[model samples]
Target: MSTEPDDIVARITEIVAAELGVPAEGLAPETDLRGIEGADSVRLLRVVAKVEQVWDVELDDADVFGVSSVADLSAVVASALQVKA
Candidate 1:
């Protein structure tokens, strides 16, 4: 898989949308995850879990906690993938 930043962001956007039961088209990299209509702690955690599964990388708890937007999550994922590589 391509570990390109743009590709990661696009994948993360889709994951976030699916986890939150929102339309993928409604989500952007800059979209605030917590501001989504159905975003709760549990659902957000599920998003994180899904991200980990898709990328085959474990994110730092600190990094996961600090993510506020899709782009932020993508950054964390990119970092994790880098460390894995």
Candidate 2:
């Protein structure tokens, strides 16, 4: 996996955009997932699933539930990568 933050964020943004059908350009690291139109648990789970797939890391349900934005999830991903490393 790339260690660069921009690369990680870009890939994550793409994954989120594809899963949520939101415009990638409109999403920021702080954008609230729950506030997005049409966002639901199932769809949000799919986003988590996709992130796991991309990083090959399994996230805890508690961590997943507490995340409110991409930046939070990205931080979890970073921690997972550190542990995996």
Candidate 3:
């Protein structure tokens, strides 16, 4: 898989959209994830779970909590991918 940020953002956007029951096109890297209609902590965690499953990378609690948007999540994912690589 490509480790580029845009690719990571695209993948994260898809995961967030599915997990939050939102349209993929409506999501963007800068979108406030918590502002999403059903994006409570549990649902966000679920999104993180799906991301980890898809990318085969484990994210730390600090990293997870530090994310407020799809872009931040993409950064975390990219960092994890780098470490894994």
lDDT of 3 by residue, 1-85 (tens): 6678899899899989999999999987899999999889999999999999988999999999999999999999999999999
Best by TM-score: 1
Quality of model 3 by C-alpha lDDT: 0.92
- Candidate 3, pairs of clashing residues: none
Q: What is the per-residue lDDT of model 1 for residues 14-82, given as tens digits with 9 covering 90 to 100?
A: 888888999999998889999999999999999999999988889999999999999999999998988
lDDT, candidate 2, 1-85, per-residue tens: 6745677777888888998898999899999988888789999999999989888999889999999998888888888888888
TM-scores for every predicted model: 0.96, 0.93, 0.94
What's the best-to-worst order under TM-score?
Answer: 1, 3, 2
- Per-model lDDT: 0.92, 0.86, 0.92
Global fold similarity of model 3 (TM-score): 0.94
The parts of candidate 2 lying over 4 Å away from their true place are: none
Lowest lDDT 10-residue stretch of candidate 3: 1-10
